[model samples]
Target chain A: MCAAASSPPAANPDRKSNAGATPDPWEACARLEYGGDRSPAWSVREELLATPPEGWPAAETRLLKSLARADATAAGRAFLCQMLALVGSAQSVPALAALLKDVDAVESARYALEAIPGAEASAALREGIAAVSGSAKAGMIGSIAIRGDTSARYLLAGIKGNPSEPAIVREAAGRALEHLATAKA
Target chain B: MPTASTVTRRRFLQQSGVATAVAAAPLILPSGLRGAGAPSRKITVGIVGAGNISDSHFGPLLGDPENVRILAVCDVDRERRDDAAARVNRTYGNQDCKAYGDFRELNRRSDIDTVFVCTPDHWHALVAIDAMRNGKDVYVEKPLTLTIQEGRALVATARKYHRVAQHGTQHRSMKRFHDVAEFVRNQGLGRLDRIECFIPPNNRHVGATWKPEPVPAGLDWDMWLGPAPWRPYTSLGCHYNFRFISDSAYGQVTNWGAHYLDIGQWALDMDASGPVEVEGRGEFPSSGLFTNATKVDFTVRYANGVPMFCRTRFEGGGTVRFVGERGWLDIARNRMSASHNDLLREMQAPGKKIQLPLSNNHHENFFACVRSRQRPIADVELGHRTTTVCNLGQIAMVLGRKLRWDPAKEEFVGDAMANRLRGRAMRSPWALI
Candidate 1:
């Protein structure tokens, strides 16, 4: 599938959520996976989202559960990850962390994890250090770098020194290493 | 439409230290709309860069049948250029739209009334200046120019020629952002204190070494390196990936900062003047094919004691926030919000809400200005000023010290090193000057 069609709701939300008293983010998101015609489902997600961010606990719990689902598409997962990237926290890490091995969602998952401030997101990326390979591996390493996670020095150093790994990943490791060092300075 | 004032243009050119500009021919209104009564036709366009970003523009322009007539496509990459031209021809159901390996050929065509400079940031100055000098209105991509000198020259030259050059910072045309900027500008936030800019760096997938790959077929490697230092062919060093390489551009500092910082400046009403001092920390790679600042925590301070913190996206998370005594307002591409709900609710409390000149579509706004001769939402000079903040921020990060800036003069106060960094020695056979 092309990148753009991978998920419709990520780019255009209103297409899914009909204008109402409250627009839903999840229903807007679910309309991506299920269909825009599933108006009632997205309405709940939107209604929950309308509870103001301070009252988003119910909304947050539902999103985390959706993220935790194993049946999620990379595009579907990325849509969720993008939303969470804005408001997610330590509690959102485990569900997102489980996807680091996901060849498709790794980038989006890492992006969400990267933005969620704290030791947990960094810890999640560092822990996924061994599980991911290819672009997923490279992406996680870079995300860890963007997070300025110095704790990954050992992991990054190993990748930087690895001869057999692809140049892209090794270069990313090297760059991430420099980032960690400079951030410390 | 603001008429091209010849006397003022000459004086401004002299003041800008441009010895001479291309003596542009008299303005020719698009044949479609001339005299008092002519059937309006599509504004003729020559798309100058056929990369992925340029492709994004195709859909919108093609969708708006009223505005687009892509007369030609040009790129250093032959295959890409032909592909773009083919798309245009396909959309128009004709093979009349031509393709060129050089942008100059595109600029030379009198039939084309407007030009879109969608090349790499480094190529922005040259392509836009060439179009302006040739008397074609331009819609160039952001960060508008790669250097301070390029920016100053572009602003002066655009005026000297009286071309409607829209700097490609799209958010300026978006209603949500215009709302936030107008709010902060009109003091809805009460006594604007400081603006905090948070932009993340980008990592284009170029490998770590200078190991050159063979030049790809149908690609003019030297032409692609136009005005930038020449190096052996690397796929990553070309196309959209070139943003990560500092020699060609200032990386994400301009790439993303152009969006976020432009919002910051727009809200602060600081497009005409910028931060008096810039300082902060940035981390560059010691050895890599890509060398833009990977880590930055820059602080740009305005003359009014309002200090803006330019930090990693993690700090405030890829948005621009205006903080003031009453409250704060935040703007991101996805969201625009205030610190308190009541502030946003009570925004229209009579003379409280400021309404900026309106624009909701980026491409249409440019086309409209081209027809009207009025400045677009993101005019060349305004775009230059916003980009100047980004360029100066990157310069400060690279130098690792606070440097004084003379925004009025568009120069560094006294730092010799910083002054030199304003412009680069373009590779021979390609010149912006």
Candidate 2:
């Protein structure tokens, strides 16, 4: 069976797929770099390079929706995250925020939300701190600091002194609060 | 309005004198117990950020006989994650390897004992800190952190958790660099007074407008920009090229700087600390997605009166040239030379004083230390100090002034503006602390 088409592109199938046909060169490039072997055909990278690096709103939403599909492979979701970093905006925040609690999607979701510039993106990340813990919580705090969102100062101050929180979290909160205080300065 | 508000805040900080103290607090390591159930018989491994650099590590790591297992791979790019995991399974002739789109999943596993942090500079802090907090040793690529504060937090976390962390200034493990650093330190070049370090501008060239592009399949663009400020992606703005943009990295200053500058620190006997003052000026692209300097020139001074001038130009294909009372010595990636032709012969005789730590391979050193629990050559503190040099140079470049750094405090000397730039504020879901 042709594995590439067996699961519709929109379906975003699981990592384990029917094995006969080769994935599209774009997907292949991602695979080649991620695995032990790099240097797939130059043609694969060029296929991506060929796409003009502008005006991606439509594709961004479509890919975000694709995450819910049962067929979504780890590679496919990761790929979507990468693209979102380039094209994502406040509109992409809700989808990314929802994944803030998902262990597998949290980092990429945070990555997308972090790079997006808007109050809504900041809100989602601020909200994310409550939903996640450990690394994910630390990551959300890091993103809030990166955004320079001073509105979270009170929230961050609370975390800095919150004894029940992990030491890493408190440390991150202190660092972010300093940034907000200094950035506002 | 921004200027007014900023001035008011600055005055408040300056009047109270409290913020500086908070920023300059000692890097105390808090108590953190190791995670339970870490594999004892074999070191379980995972990979994060499977980019081109991943190739350099995977071969050496995956091939370690009987003691190493590549159990999982994670990356924002799905294709890379799945493919990398599949490849690992293929190498071991099994289908047990797991693919994760989020590094947190890799961080959550008590079974995996180590993680290869091959991500971009910006993601290093969160990923490394999280893994250490969860009880995994890390081999993180350099400039260890994108900002000085991030480096401090990571170092504290490593110490607090008692994890063996290796920063990816691989030159520490190479014999060529080790040989020269030892010779310079041992007075082979006589009383060292000055050293000149150099690297290429590495800005390359590209157009400016950072408009959004069509999000590609099999790539998570958002995850790629983790913890960095939001900007619409241009083709050149993402991928390995993120270095050019000041938002994600400090260009070749940190890129090439992390490797060669590290060697300088080792030679100058300043690995445990850093320069006391830094002043620099360089050419920045007037308009583009990249904001780091193109033609770099920076000068740093140690407390010992040894001055190191760093530049981005070529003189004899050299990475650094150490000048001493006897003569001068030059060393680069491919070759090394000295004022006296016989200096090489004398140094190679093997009874040389001050023999530096030796590790012929970076990957081997890291895994060896994992078992022994000894600090690798490029340990977290060493990595932090070296990266601090680059950050200082870049900070001075941006501030357009000579800034005195209190290396003991790891903060600028009363310069709130420069101090503030030490690290950036994160947006959400991420903080460097």
Scored by DockQ, the top model is: 2
Residue A141 shift from truth in candidate 2, angstroms: 6.4
Which segments of candidate 2 are over 4 A away from where they belong? Answer: A1-185, B1-40, B206-210, B314-318
So what's the TM-score on candidate 1? 0.64
Per-residue accuracy of model 1 over B160-229 as CA lDDT, tens digit each: 6777788889998676787778777787777888788788755544225555688889998878877564
Every candidate's DockQ is: 0.01, 0.08
| Predicted structure with the largest lDDT when compared to the true one | 2
Question: Compared with the true structure, what per-residue lDDT tens digits does model 2 show for residues A1-185?
Answer: 01221332122121112112344433443342221122222232223222332435655555566656655555455656655665567778888888887877677677667666679988988888888886567778877876789999999999989899988788888878876775643
Which runs of model 1 end up more than 4 angstroms from their true locations?
A1-185, B1-39, B204-207, B314-317, B348-354
Per-candidate local distance difference test: 0.70, 0.71
lDDT of 1 at B417: 51
Tens digits of per-residue lDDT for model 1, A1-185:
01121332122232223333336445345334311232333344334433445655566677777666656554456557655665577888887787776655666677667667689988998998788776567767766775667778988899889899888688778766865776653
> Least accurate stretch of 10 residues (summed lDDT) in model 1 chain B?
B16-25
